[model samples]
Target: MGLFILCFLTTGGALDYLYFDAFTPSGPTLPAATLFSLGAASMITLAAYHGGGSLILGSLGAERPDTQIPEHRELRNIVTEMALASGAAMPQVYVIYDPAPNALATGTNDKNSAICVTTGLLALLDREETQGVVAHEMSHIRNEDILLMTMVSILLGGIAILADLGRRGFYSPRAGQRLGRKTPLLLLPLSLLIGLAPLIGRILSMAVSRQREYLADATAAQYTRNPVGLARALEKIRDAAIPFRGATRGTAHLFFTSPLRRRLENSDSRLAHLLTTHPPINRRIELLYRMAGIMRPPVQNTRNASTRSA
Candidate 1:
């Protein structure tokens, strides 16, 4: 968040580095801290309001039951049943169009939780594979990982805004400019560093932690009673080179698989895993391998449900 603020402030300074300088009123030039405060408040306020609004609008208008796709009923039923069995309430379902296969669950809290799927995901994965993905997302909802994601975003964004503000204060009016010339070069870079702090913080925040994903996987397996289903699904995702389009770094953690296109580099490589929300695919796959043996038969077979209803 600091980085975001810094970037915002620094960039503003870098550009009109002159504009902020004008604000130092005779009384006590607006404290450089105030600019950062403004940035933090401005950016995060936008993120929270915008993020919360989008989720609401998307569900109310775009994901109405009547507008849901034909297969939505069956999918919803399965998920609802699973939730019931798990002692959790049902989450709203949404169908989104995108070429890359993916799904995500989100909400500020459980009561408001919603799940979304990409057209690409629906079209690409086989039935069991799809189940795996949904189950993974369901796990997030059940565990409140969804809420954490939003919390993280708000915090990160706020930090960036502050960082930006600080940068803006560095350069200023004639008086400030005079100070800058006299100040050590160190202060300039320090100001820039302040803005970058948020970005660094974000990379560290990554996912809910590796253990959470494992537990989610376990929960899904328990729900579906089909470790192979999820395992196979993960394999297909790992092997497929097709990209999950329209993914944002902010939302990547929301997906069952990392939304990032599979790169030639190792996920554990410094660049790949540095601050990603997901653990490496290989590690997740290995856990699945362990579960494959103990995977119990599903108490409710979706295939049977589909066939019986069809």
Candidate 2:
């Protein structure tokens, strides 16, 4: 929210400077224009926040899973088990027909939330692994990470919208006249800041998302009492060579794993780490195994250890 306000001020100030001559003595006062911009941005952001989950699910083509299918039925059962274990209300369930293995939870709160998974996930993971994934999502609901993420997504959108408006203002006849009078040195800095605001907001949003994912992994282990199940699930997802066709930059962070796969996601470089949405998959898997008090091993060996631990 603080980030959104800062972006609002920066972008709004740029627009006011370009179009309204905010610094000129005869023009509207800078403080008044700023207040108006802040008010407008807040309303748009609130509306988006209220409808964020539905918008995200609709964009992904998520729909209620057909319970006639055994896999779908099992998914609901696992959701119920995890909900009970975590003491959260049963979230509405939906499925995407995409052939990429991924899942997400979304809503403003526990009572209103929904969980959606891909058909590919049902096909790829066994019962235990499915439960593990479901538990991770349930942890998101129980911890109110859903609300946190929803707010961040909306704020990022708000920044992008403001940036677009700023771009449009630059081309307007009135703005061009005002620009002629303004010092070139003053305009340059404001233009550059407005252009870069969205990129900065995205990097901050991804950092928040990565931290929440780590927390969700730990909470899922506590709920299921089986960290290895989630560890193995992460390993499989990491190795899967499929692209999520429904993914977009705006919605990628909502998924269990990053829907848009990039080679940098696996890189150890600090710059690479900042550019990725989620933490390195291998790092997440290793943490889950550590929670289980076991050294990470090959998939088959981990399976045997999982069985023995169970």
Candidate 3:
């Protein structure tokens, strides 16, 4: 939240400078513009949380399971068991009819929460692996990670919107010379600052998101007492390399894996990783294996005989 506020303030400051120095002579000065920007940011954040669940699911084309079939019943049962284990309400479950294997949890609170998974996930994962994925999402609900991610997403959107508006208004052919004509000394610095605000904010947001994912992984392991299940689920997701068709930059953070192209995970660039919401799959699997007191899972199901210790 601090990062969100800081990014908002920085972007607001740039916008204020642009208005006073370039856009309109009578435009809201620094103080008034700041207030307006703050109000806008507040509205965006409130709307995000107000009907956030519906907005998220609707954006992803998610549908409530018909619940008439045996398979759907089993899916609901897994959710019920995980919700019990995580001490959260049995959140409404929805299905996305995509070929990508992924899932997410969202709501303003535990009682209002919903979990959505793709058809691909159901087709790909075994019972234990499915339990692990469900447990990981439930952990997000337990930790209110959904709320945190939603907040970040709103702020990121605000920053991007503000930055884009500032750039277009400042750089348009008619106004491109406005800054230079009026404030020769400030044009370059201001332009650079305004341009970089969105990128910087996105990077910080993704870094925080990656950390939360690690914590969720740990918590899921604790709840299920079977880190290997999630480990295997993640491995499968990595190998499948199918992107969720419905995911966009706005909702990508909600997914268990990156919903962008498979090549995103393949990038070895340090800068590329910072902009991604998830840590590398292999690193996550290694941590889960460590949590399970095994360096790595054996070729076979050696851990299958071990039950989840109460």
Scored by lDDT, model 1 comes in at 0.61
Query: Is 1 or 2 the stronger prediction by lDDT?
Result: 2
State the lDDT of candidate 2 residue by residue for 37-122, as single tens digits.
69867875676568878877888899998979999999999999999999999999999998899999998889889999999999
- For each candidate, the alpha-carbon lDDT, in order, equals 0.61, 0.83, 0.79
Which number leads on lDDT? 2
TM-score winner between 1 and 3, please give it.
3
Compare candidates 1 and 2 on TM-score and give the better one.
2
Clashing pairs for predicted structure model 3, backbone only: none
- The alpha-carbon deviation from the true structure for residue 39 of candidate 3, after best TM-score superposition, in angstroms, is 0.6
- Predicted candidate 1 versus true structure: per-residue lDDT over 1-310, tens digit per residue: 3344444454434323333433334423554544655565576656654475254335323353433565666567666766775667787877766566667777765677777777666666777777777888788888877776655556565565555655555554553654454336644655556666666656755635444677888888887878777877766666553556555555566667777764422256766666666777666666776787644322232333465599
For candidate 2, the per-residue lDDT at 199 reads 87
Q: Per-residue error at 36 for model 3, in Å?
A: 2.1
The prediction achieving the highest TM-score against the true structure is: 2
Candidate 1 Cα outliers beyond 4 Å, as residue runs: 1-68, 161-189, 207-211, 262-266, 294-310
lDDT ranking, high to low: 2, 3, 1
Reference-based lDDT, residue 25, model 2: 84
